[model samples]
Target chain A: MRLSENRPSPRVRAGRELPLSGKDLLGLLSEVLAKGVRIRFRASGYSMSPFIRDGDVITVRPCKKTDLRKGAVAAYVRPMNGHLAVHRIVGGTEAGFALKGDHEPIADYPVAASGIIGVVDRVERNGRRVRLGIGPEKGLVAALSARGLITWAFRAFGRNKGSVT
Target chain B: MTDRTGLDRIFKPSEEIVAREIEGELIIVPLTAGIGDIEDELFTFNASGRAIWKGLDGRKPLKAIIGELAAQFEGDPEEIEEDVLGLVEELVKRRIVVEVV
Candidate 1:
């Protein structure tokens, strides 16, 4: 009559998502990428707008320092506060590499190779893969961003009105 | 008291998962298609769940785990067994836990 009435259910509950601080997320990403695994998370800012906007899903792959190149978008630990940041590699110096946000006028301080976490390999928006900013034109974009001319060019050409990555 | 068949089995967390304990909670991310998609596929366990998770070391049988938990938590042995077995079954179903041969 009550064949399963004596059975007790499991109490373990699995959550679908967990919110993490910048430091905590970077810690997890560093650990996972060190294991040669790739990670994907939603982007949270507009610093790399047009190319990588807010709420875009980004995939980062593990790479050695030797794999870094100018124009490629990378995730690195910001020296200012030790938080994680994703920006474009605008140039390189003896100290390290120069990174700048596409919409910002200034380049961040040189980031050592060790501070670079991983390279952004893919970006997705609205279930579609966005390919404009991370493509071959990245070199030109980096060059423009390095000179603090990206935003100016967008404003001058009236391309900032639409998504012109 | 129900199904005792799984009592002697030992289960280990799958290699496809990356787990870390932060702030007394166990956070787990499963690598789907070789990518750790934290935005949509993340899991967390509470304190008691963490205790059970720690006992699944691949070297301890379910019976021993149940005994240890029962002793540590001062709960009924039968209730602990049910909880452990229930969690293990769920983990196994999700492919997050694998039974060691």
Candidate 2:
């Protein structure tokens, strides 16, 4: 009956159900504590060799398609199924834009504007927050994309096909 | 036994499905569908069932999970094993899931 009582983690063993999924948790803290935040209970195996590994928490900022700049990551509903895919913009589109992960050694494909979710402006790492704003390191991501390094291992091992570069 | 080396099945063009726990229920939205059908099939579960379902990552085996869940939930291990196997069989049949490492 008591939820926390059944949890396995000592801190969470009390069955303290944290209703805050990464997304809701970010929004709640943003409004209450007034700190910019964004995250969600994300689970997927598509994007590979991401500087961000699977199960890592990220801070996303909801943005408009017009606001998307080169080298910013966005999460959006797939035009087909609306599955949330977190990837960075490699090329710009007047309607939507093209997205590919730095680790993905695939070609750049365009997604419709409707599929766009939000730009990931930051991520919470270890206990500190890291912001993902535009910068020079963008070149590194490109070179890796060219070499197909970050995503090479995952592409060889990922469940998803090597579709996007 | 697994179907094949993870390589043979890796590039067969499987659609990406979005699954999430919304309001205590797990919802899987298929990214690619049969056109114009707004509602896809849904899978529902209770609290305990959800716990067991969450444990079904591509890694662990069905038998191992039964023993783990029995201890965690304080249930009959044999009975739980049957239940877990039944669920896995159903999931595989539906094509919503695949046995993978």
Candidate 3:
């Protein structure tokens, strides 16, 4: 599957708005979350493809560290850059937890329970909204993400979709 | 009635408002409704707004804040007071700024 597939296309400018860097946006997100806020933003990138499209809007809620389980999708701070990263919790380690992008093969640096910002609760796609929680779909996705096979599945789905024309 | 110009009244940032500084820019988010909803709009400030926000310590009076701002920038005290008062009034209306007893 092409990397840019399912991405939001560039649109014409309506008016000039102050530009915010990714770091600034994440910092703002963290600040609001600290204040017990729930936030949503249009998804970007292909890290969690098929499950979460680039233009899909996601709603995240503050959650307890213990609430997260393997195969759950979460937003966390990357230890290396202190930036926000959204990925699936494939498994856990003695240090903390192991997280990986659904589209990437490698697991990211293990993040402490405190490093997690929130858990995704809802995703809106094509005017339809779906709530995410412990369920069969979550379990299956978790299993696939844990084994690093989600990318392959996504690729297969993409090829099949492309051939449908 | 309390004198509005008195420097004795304390003015503090409302607990309902949360703010942060990133890359020299001030970002203000209001959490009055218990939590900040990302769907709500956010307020961002540049250099001038930063200057005014930094002066909102609960201990400082409105007059004193105006003086400090006037000394820091080249604007006349009258103009500064007008601008500061306008912004502070808006903040008060939004509950982003509160008066201390």
Best by TM-score: 1
Candidate 1, residues B1-101, lDDT tens digits: the string is 32325688888999878888765567788875878878677777655666788888989999998887776776567777777888788888777888888
Tens-digit lDDT track for model 2 on A47-145?
633455554455555576465766667765444544456776766556567677665656345787656656665554454554432345654554455
- On DockQ, the leading prediction is 1
- Model 3 agreement with the true structure over A33-115: per-residue lDDT tens digits: 77787776666777877677676777777888666888778889999888788888888889888988877778899998999
Cα lDDT tens digits, model 1, A4-26, are 23343223332324557777789
Alpha-carbon DockQ of candidate 2? 0.02
Worst 10 residues of 3 chain B by lDDT: B33-42
Model 3 clash tally, residue pairs: 2
Per-residue lDDT tens digits of candidate 3, residues B1-101? 56665445557788876677645645566775555543435566545555666778887888887778777777456767766666677777778779876
Rank candidates, DockQ, best first: 1, 3, 2
TM-score of 2: 0.40
Residue A20 shift from truth in candidate 2, angstroms: 12
lDDT: which is higher, 1 or 2?
Answer: 1
The candidate 3 chain A region of ten consecutive residues with least summed lDDT is A7-16
